[model samples]
Target: MSINIDIRLKKACKIFREGENISGLILLQTNSDVKHDGIFLTMEGAVNLQLSSKTVGIFEAFYNSVKPIQLVQYTVEVVPAGKIPSGKTEIPFELPLKPRGNKSLYETYHGVFVNIQYMLRCDIKRSFLAKGVSKSLEFIVEDRRPVKKTDREQSKAVSFRIKPESLQNTRDKSNVPRFCISGKIDSLSCRLSDPLIGEVVIESCETVIKSVELQLVRVETCGCAEGYSRDATEIQNIQVGEGNVCTGLAIPIYMVFPRLFTCPTLSTSNFKVEFEVNLIVVFEDDYLVTENFPIILTRH
Candidate 1:
């Protein structure tokens, strides 16, 4: 009897944010004569963060800076060591990352997140042994939020990230999609005139007939949380804010992203990253929020 075993990742091409969950399916097809206990599937990772500073002032004072970020990875699996007839099967797994409190700054401890990788193999000496196929994924990340207000004036700011990533040797990219401001709202926080899950608006004054459109602002990229950790710098950040407004008012905004494409690279990764600190005013009504940051990328 003869049999064929092929595994393919079905949902691996979807977009993902850092703070959220990563779920996917693996399809297995077999037709000939084969017997294996249980099939196998796995998730692996390789992380890196790099930073550098360039100074330009009076003959080399302080001018500018640049940083680098990269990741290299692959996956494999194995099945039970037995043999039997042929059939089809599917497997699923979730890949999760810890919440990074800050970027790679201060010291080289927090900014750089490198984890051990795993390997999975499937073999049936009497059947088929597939252990030589692999794929590569490379992508960039960056986002932010800012707020400032006064008794008479209100200022608001917003920030996010975008750059096509190179994955599986295929360049699938997303554009500079605006963070439209989408989020959940508590029923108790709703007023008669306000709809739940509304747009982020600056409405403290009556003179302007309309509220201002807030764009993501660039704060301190590669900023250290101070004494907690140290880093070389590629960690990026962006922020958005509005001027002075009332002291006890609340504001909300939704996060929006561009449509998905054929490539595995995601355009806006809001849930998967860690962001900290802002000089702007943050409202009390914020049940949940997503931020974006910008970064410099070079294709090799």
Candidate 2:
């Protein structure tokens, strides 16, 4: 007899979040009456980081290996594996998705170097020489919290300034800057659903000011020969000046963080994930100035 299985979630989409209920139905169909040792289902969530190093040193290279780290994990058994009669059967389940107290549930992340995921597995136990059937489903989990006044105090605004002569002294590029940008954000701690608000002041250089931009950058690091790397995407941009920038000019800053793509800053022994606010300045000579401030993204 042919057997088939499918999972049905109470919600329309498979999307879910922490501190939420996960309730669903397991549908089983068979062409004829089927008997089994038992049937079971399991739900699991985990964060795994793997690092391999072959270039750390000759001795380390000889013993190069991947290290696995589990940042979060949750599991539950839905049904204990014996069953028979079946044209179709439905088994329902309800489970809370949060981990233990004080342990934050990380957002689902999949990277070339690290992975965080959640899933459900179903197994049909069979007797004799028959093989047991199994199936699995993956879901997205987002974790967000309310921001408190205490969280605001943890982030401090960073400020800096630029001079026109600083741009001309390319001879001492290491010490001189073309333009100086100084600003104060409302707070460095932000939510994925909240707007980032701040003000920026620019000191004009010899060249005409083109535009100013803000970027949300994600940096992922692993214990590898290259160490760590970064990816930056523009969040917002506007023209603050046309000709030379006038000193003491205030430019208002506003940007909404995307809820679906942004992940909170996280760190582990073998891997680290972080987010930052980047300010980019462009001049007529194609001269550019960039300033960065480390920021923490939290649900709360």
Candidate 3:
């Protein structure tokens, strides 16, 4: 009996993400068409690091060191029946990862490595004599390690600052406010400590509202003149003034609401007119990167 063969591996090298399946193909061939008994494959893992050090005086300062890690093994096998013609084919297999050593150097890192050495054992029986053929394949497995502690610790401790130094509100003498609402953010901090801007805004309609005293009330519950309202509201005192407006007040704002008078509702025309202001603020940190916002209102 005569046995001729051709053997090749899909790749002499392979790579995998831990926990993912490691797979590849094995190619086998026969010459002049021969009957084959079966096919089987197996793999093993090994890790090694070689280091060199210095020598001092007459004695060797340090010796060349070699570290050999543990080995893990895996195996797969498949058999083809009856006589087969000479050709080539693939045998696919998988590799499942089990956790390695627990120490830092023992632990896997971005470049941690594993070497896979494999063997394909073929046992063929023909006529009165039996013969076996085995082949070898070598592969490399690399670890794509996750981020470590040092990187996370470096991202905390944020700082902030406000620009321009002054916050201003400019308004006109109309029923609505007459001014520009502007301010700058210099410093703001959060638990993560990343310097940032939290919340900055001009209350606009809700920012600052002035109240006038109600002189009297009308029977028509919804449209009475300034003097015709259910509430008697008046603001006659201002402790601090800024740019034609009061910055601080001692007057109890609740005392100026429609509730105090319990009279008819004021004219809807007053409510129909909306207040306008330019809301301007810059949100930034010590680094100077920022988001600039603008607030504008147009009356048609």
Top candidate by lDDT: 2
Q: Candidate 3: lDDT of 31?
A: 56
Leading candidate by TM-score: 2
Give lDDT per model, in order: 0.29, 0.66, 0.31
Each model's TM-score?
0.27, 0.67, 0.32
lDDT of 2: 0.66
TM-score of 1: 0.27
- The true-versus-predicted C-alpha distance at residue 244 of model 3, in Å, is 68
Tens digit per residue, CA lDDT, model 3, 1-300: 344333343444443334655455555566556665656555544434222122122222112222344454555555554565566554555555443454111111111111122223334444345566565554433434443444344334322232223222323323332323323322211111122222222223223433211121112111113321122122122221122233222211111112111211111321111111111222222111122221111100
How much does candidate 3 score in TM-score? 0.32
User: What is candidate 1's local distance difference test score?
Assistant: 0.29
Q: What shift in Å separates residue 27 of candidate 1 from its native position after superposition?
A: 0.3
- lDDT per residue, candidate 1, 209-253, as tens digits? 112223322122231222111222232222333443432344554
Model 3: residue 83 alpha-carbon error in angstroms: 6.5
Residue 265, model 2: lDDT of 68
Q: Per-residue alpha-carbon lDDT of model 2 for 65-155, expressed as tens digits?
A: 2354443445455665456466888889787777654666678776544567778777788887888878888877876655556657766
Which segments of model 2 are wrong by more than 4 Å? 1-4, 11-21, 29-37, 50-66, 71-88, 96-107, 126-133, 140-151, 155-160, 163-171, 174-183, 199-205, 208-211, 223-252, 284-286
